[model samples]
Target: MDAFTTAWAGLTGWIFETLVQPAFYALGLMDWAEDAYDWLDFGLYGLLTIAIVYLVCRPLEAWRPVEPVADRRAIRTDMVYTFLARLGVLPLLAFVLLASLQTRWEGWLTEEGLLPPTLEEIFPPLRAAPLLAFLVYVVVLDFGEYWRHRAQHGLRWWWALHAIHHAQRQMTFWTDDRNHILDDVLAALWFGGIALLIGVPPGQFPFILLVLRLAESMSHANVRLSYGRLGERLVVSPRFHRLHHGELSAGAAGKNYAVLLPVWDWIFGTADWNRDAYPRTGAPGTEEAMATGGWVRQQWAGFRRVALALAGRG
Candidate 1:
C-alpha cells in the first residue's frame, strides 16, 4: 500500500503540474491552488475507483450476470452521471457548501450554549490512534448513510428526488451515482454534516468516501453473486443490495438501505435474507424519461416530481 500510494502521488503530481497548474497559472487563479489540488485529488481518486470497479465487477457481470445489458443507452447515461459526479463539478459544489450550511445546524442547542463534541473529544484514546479513529469515523459516517438512505425513501419529497436513482432499470456499476442534483446536494449535506460532527479531517474524507463508493458500485453491479451467508450478514453483498433495487422494493417500502454494512438493515427490519432473490431492478409508476433520458432531462423531471410531492399533488 505504501509503495502504491507513493507511485500514485507521483502520478497525480505530474498530472496536476502538467495540466491543472498551468491552467490555473494562466487564469491568474493561483489563490485557488490548494482547492484545485484537492479537486484534483478527488478526480484522481474517482478515476481510480472507476477503473478498479470496472476491473473487478465487469468480469463478474460477464461471468454470472443476473440480467443481460439489453439497454446500453441507459447504462451510458449512468456513466455520464458517474463521471460528472466524481469529477468534482456537482460534488465540489456540495463540499464548498458544507462549511456554511452545517456551521451551527445543531438548532436551538447551538443557541443555548450547547454544542456537539467531536468523537475524539468524547473518547480521548482515539487521538493516539489516528488510523483507528479514521476507521471509527468511517463506521460512524456509514451509520449516518444508512439513515440518510432511509430518509430518501420515508420522506415523500426526498423520495421524489431519490426516485431518479431507483429508476435505473439497467442498473450497473456505473449507476451508483445516477442521482438528481438536488438529491446529490442533500446527500452531500448528510455526509458532510456527519463527517464534521465526527471530526474527520478534510484530507481523510476521500479515503472513506472511496471505500464506501467501491462497495456501492460493487453492490449495484450486474453480477449474480453473494458473499455466502455470514459474509452477506457482515457486509453488503451484490445480491443483498440488488434486492433493495428490486422492482417491488423501491420507494417508502424499501429494504436493505445500508450503504456499506448489511447489519443496519438486519437490525432495522429492512433486510431481505432470501439469498436467491434477484428481481428486476427499477421503480414503478415513473415516466420513461427519468429512466432513459439524458442527465439534464432527468434532473428536470426530478425537480418537477419533488415539487409535486411537496405540494401534496403527486
Candidate 2:
C-alpha cells in the first residue's frame, strides 16, 4: 500500500481508539452499538449536508437574476440525470469498505509496536499544534484535490467518467455531486490515498472530510456568494466556481476548473471570471437531442460519440 493508505488506516484506528470510544463510553451505549452509532452519525450528517446545499441554492433566484433558459423540460431532464448519478454513491461506499479492510489487515506501524498510535500519541502537541496542523493539512488536501481534478480533464479516458458530471444543463449545489460511479470511486481513491500517504491520523479524517464536503457544497451553490475581489483571492466562492460550469462561448469552455482555490486556476491560466458578462449554462448539445434516448441511451450515445472522434471517424 501507498503511504497515504497506510497513514489513513492508522488515523482511522486512532480516531476510533480516542474520540469515538470515549464518546461511546460517555453516552453509555452498548459496546456492540458503537459501530452502529458511528454509521448513524455519518448518515445524519450526510443528509444534513445535502439539505444545506439545497437551502443555499434556493435563494439564487433573486440575487443574480438571469433569464431562465425557458426550458423547464431540460431542467427536469437534468434533475433525472442527477438522480441517476446517486447510484454513483455505491461505488464510493465500496471504496470506503475496501480501504477499511486493507488498513485493518495490514496493521499500523508504530514506534514500539505494530499497532497504530493513539491520537494523543501520534500528535502529542495537539494542544499547541492542532489548529495549525489542521489548517496546513486542509490546504495540502485541497491542493491534491485540485490537481486530481485537473488530471481528470486533461486525461482522455478519465474524462469519460467526469463528463457525466458536466452533463448537467444547470449549475446548482446538487450539480457538485452529479458524477459517474467510476468518477466517484476514483475521487475517493485519490483523496483517501493522499490523506493516508501524508500520515494524517484517523481522528482527523472525519473532521477534514466534513470541512471539505461543506466547502464543496458552498462552491457549487447557485446563491450569490461572491467573495468580492479580496475574498476571491483567498478561497473559492460561488461566482468563481460557476465559471467552471459555464458553457463554452467562443471556444472558452474548459476554463476555471479549480475546486477550492482560484489561485491554482489563475496560476495555471484556466481562470475565466468575467463578472461583466453572464455566462450561458448547459452542455454543447440541445436538451431535446439529449433527452430523446433516455438516460442510459444518452450515456451510450455520448460514449459512442467520443469513441468515434477518437477513431477519427467523426
Candidate 3:
C-alpha cells in the first residue's frame, strides 16, 4: 500500500507540475494551487477508477446481460454523466468548496487544542491495526451512505433529482454516476461530513472512496449474476441491486438501498433476497427527456422536477 501510494503521489505531482501548474500560472490562479493539486489527485483517481470499472464490468455485462443494448444513445448519455461527474468540472468544484471548508474547520479545532474524534480514538485497539481501522472507516462510511440513499427516496424533492438515475432503462456500470449535479453535491456533503465526524485519515480517504465506487459500479452492471442466498446477505450483488432499480421499485417504495453491504438492508428490513429476480430497470412516470435526452436535457428536467416538487406542484 505504501509503495502504491508513493507511486500515485509521484505521478500526480509530475502531472501537476508539467501541465496543470503551468495552465494555472497562465490563468493567474496560483492562489488556488493547493486545492487544485488535490483536485488533480481526485481527477487522476477518477480516471483510474473508470478504467478499472470498465475492464471488470464490461465483460460480465456482455456475458449475461439482463437486457439487450437497445438504446445506445441513452447509454452514451450515461457515459457523459460518468465522465463529467468523475473527472470533469465536478471534481474541481467539489474539491475547491469542500477542501477549503475542511481546512478551516480542522485548523480552528487544532488551535483550540482539541482533537477531532475518530474510530481509533473511540476504540484504542484499532489504533495499532491500520488495516482494521481502514475497514472500520469503510463500514462507518457505508452505513452513512445507506441512510443517505434512503433519504433520497423518502424525501420528495430529493427524489425529484434522484429520479434521473433511476430513469435509465439501459443501466450499465456507467449508470452509477448518472445523477443530477445537486444530487451529487448533497451526496458529497453527506459522505464528506461523515468522514469529518469520524476523523477518517487523509491518506485512507482515496482508497475508501475507490472501494465503495467499484462496488457501486459493479452493482449497477447489467449482469444476470448473484452471490447466492447467504452471499447476497453479505455483500450487495448485481441481482440484488437490479431489483432496487426495478420499474416497480422507484421512489419511496424502493428496496435494497445499501451501497456496498447488503447487511445494512438486511438489518433495516429493506433487503429483497430473491436471487432469481432481475426485473426490468427504470423509473416509471419519469419525464421522457430525463429518460432518453442528452446530458443538458436530463439535468434541466431534473432541475424542473425538483423545482416543482419544492413548490408542492409535483
What are the TM-scores, per candidate, against the unseen true structure? Answer: 0.91, 0.68, 0.92
Candidate 3, poorest ten consecutive residues by summed lDDT: 200-209
Lowest lDDT 10-mer window, candidate 1?
A: 99-108
**lDDT, residue 239, model 2:** 74
**Model 2, position 189: C-alpha lDDT score:** 76
lDDT of 3 by residue, 269-309 (tens): 99888888989999999899989999999999999999999
Listing every candidate in turn, what is its Cα RMSD in Å to the true structure after a full C-alpha superposition?
A: 2.8, 9.1, 2.3
What stretches of model 1 exceed 4 Å from their correct place?
1-3, 25-28, 100-116, 204-209
Best by lDDT: 3
Q: What is the per-residue lDDT of model 1 for residues 223-249, given as tens digits with 9 covering 90 to 100?
A: 998999899998788899999999899
Clashing pairs in 3: none
Q: What is the lDDT of residue 120 in candidate 1?
A: 84
lDDT of 2 at 20: 70
Candidates 1 and 3 compared: the better one by TM-score is 3
By descending TM-score, how would the candidates be arranged?
Answer: 3, 1, 2
lDDT of each: 0.87, 0.60, 0.89
Off by over 4 Å in 3: 1-10, 26-28, 107-113, 204-209
